[model samples]
Target: MTFKAAKEFNTPVGNYCYYHISRETYPIGITQIKEGNSVYIMATPEKALCDLIANQPGINLRYKKEALEFLEENLRFDMDKFCQFNPEIFLAYAKNGKKSTSILTILKLLQHE
Candidate 1:
């Protein structure tokens, strides 16, 4: 499932989008973040990383260093919180080599970098 912002709505926060796999429908690694009086159900760092790779099939994270740079610089992921996640669940969603390899590569980089 894919959720995109409607053009009819305008906000200073820009557009928000999300993609989810149908089989993995259960809401896992999701948390609530409040801003002022509004609360939002957002995915955890782990879930967000998996979703990023899954949604973008053409992503180029060829090497460990590349993955590190992408996650640290391009994405700015929270490493401490990310490492706390269960690696097994992340691997379960990475069906093919594309997302799987990328996730694995990032995990490896997390160890040394």
Candidate 2:
């Protein structure tokens, strides 16, 4: 995923695979997992959710209500697990990623909950 806005493309590999191109440095939470001879680099749950919010088009969450609606109604996210996410990761993403206002709104929503 990328911090900068660019054309989004999908690779046809059974399930569609989308990739983001980055032009600047940004904070990301990732983990490397190894199984036998294979290693996989994956984004943490916090980072994945942040990336989804930041990268998705037409998402302009500027208030707690909007953020909450998107999370609960649109995404059907489990509110029980919402509070478990690391706030610091969202803060870091908000600092260096796109859609700062939306990201901050999410942070604020989390805090209020």
Candidate 3:
């Protein structure tokens, strides 16, 4: 699937637009599928993989330092506590190298020079 985001909706966190739907009490990551019309998977990891592996088809929410910090501060050791609660996504992230992936991307967005 193509990773497409609304150009008009960039967030203060940068890059990935905030997935706000109003009804959602807690803000969770969301990808707007124009074709599938699915809200996509929540920010959790396990369901993200399940959605993709099971062929649910959703874009991954890109995050860097701020996101990691948020996850670390709020989530800590338990991976499932994040929103919809998926663990495999974290595993996939670790396998793919989170340091180089979103972490680098995060620094670039926040750099002030």
Best by TM-score: 2
Candidate 3 stretches with Cα past 4 Å from truth are 10-42, 45-85, 97-113
lDDT of 2 by residue, 1-113 (tens): 64455444555655443546354423466678899999988888878887888778899999899999999999999998998888888888888787878989999988885
lDDT of 3 at 86: 36
Clashing residue pairs in candidate 1, if any? none
> How much does candidate 1 score in TM-score?
0.58
| lDDT (C-alpha, whole model) for all candidates | 0.63, 0.79, 0.36
Cα miss at 28, model 3 (Å)?
15
Q: Write the per-residue lDDT of candidate 1 for residues 45-99, one digit (tens) a residue.
A: 6766776775685776659878867877888877676567666556555543236
lDDT by residue (1-113, candidate 3, tens digit) is 22333234456776543322222222222334444655544444432332232222232325554544644563463533444343334334433432323433322333321
Pairs that collide, model 2: none
Q: In terms of lDDT, which candidate is stronger, 1 or 3?
A: 1
Number of clashing pairs, model 1? 0
- Model 1 ranges with Cα > 4 A deviation: 1-14, 18-20, 25-41, 96-98, 111-113
RMSD of each: 4.8, 3.0, 13.9
